[model samples]
Target: MSRSIDYGNLMHRAMRGLIQEVLADVADNGLPGNHHFFITFDTTHEDARLADWLRDRYPREMTVVLQHWFDNLVVGDDGFGISLNFGDSPERLFIPYDSILTFVDPSVEFGLRFETQDQESEAEDAEASPPLRARRDEPETEAEADAAGDEDEAQDAEVVQLDKFRK
Candidate 1:
């Protein structure tokens, strides 16, 4: 075995990149059809920013559905921002990608789970995107953001099983 290699970290980075690519595509064009995202993240993560009310509701982890109701979905180098409705009120959220735990596109049964520990402390690598900084004066309401797309036709997807990717 090559002691200098860190395949697990590389795999994690690659997986994150894939998610970013998908989100970037969605930003360009709205979710195609029948496709939506179920994203789970650490609600209490240092980089996560949510309305006080929402944070109080989900003190630890929370999953959000990116379907028909979200707006202002902006995918930045390090994180993403979106506006979700809370009892008819639109609340904005900013979540760093590092805080993400599970990302699933059920339409195709494609899912990825990331190991969350040490996520924030890890030094930035070439493969990772740069961090995003929020502008204090930016508008709260932005143009509606596009959703992730999915295919209407269902096809068998192969499952790749692996032990924990972290040592």
Candidate 2:
């Protein structure tokens, strides 16, 4: 058998490390400048923790905005913990780094998306699965733009795909 370096997995680990470093900085110094995050993760992941209601509502995936009013940001080697408001109710969530799907910083037009082989196969089987590409389209409505923090309008956002580097 030919053994080769798993560059895709390596890149994924590096990207996740980058997110961890950035989150650690924000936990200590708060979000700098106009930077904020839209983090989407797999709600069904084994280590992912959230309110039962939230899981019911979000089912497979959930996207959380880390802007305005959030508290108790804690970064750890395996994952992070944060408290966010949902309909005036503050709920704490523990999101394992491995569960994350996409991390976006619309302020700087930057984004990262991670896909595992299992997820790719599942996506192919599921018709409603979201597109693999990170969308950089303009927001169609004011409400959407505000609620999503203009993520859809990030025209220059660079979405990194490790597959391109694979042999």
| Most accurate candidate by lDDT | 2
Model 1, C-alpha of 163: deviation from truth (Å): 25
Provide the global lDDT of candidate 1 against the true structure: 0.72
lDDT of 2 by residue, 44-106 (tens): 999999999999999999999998989999999999999999999999999999999888888
Compared with the true structure, all predictions reach lDDT values of 0.72, 0.83
What would the TM-score be for candidate 2 when compared with the true structure?
A: 0.74
TM-score of each: 0.67, 0.74
Candidate 1 runs further than 4 Å off: 1-3, 118-167
Count residue pairs with overlapping backbones in model 2: 0
- In Å, residue 107's CA in model 1 sits off its true spot by 0.6
The residue-level lDDT of candidate 2 at 140 comes to 31
- Pairs that collide in candidate 1 are 72-145
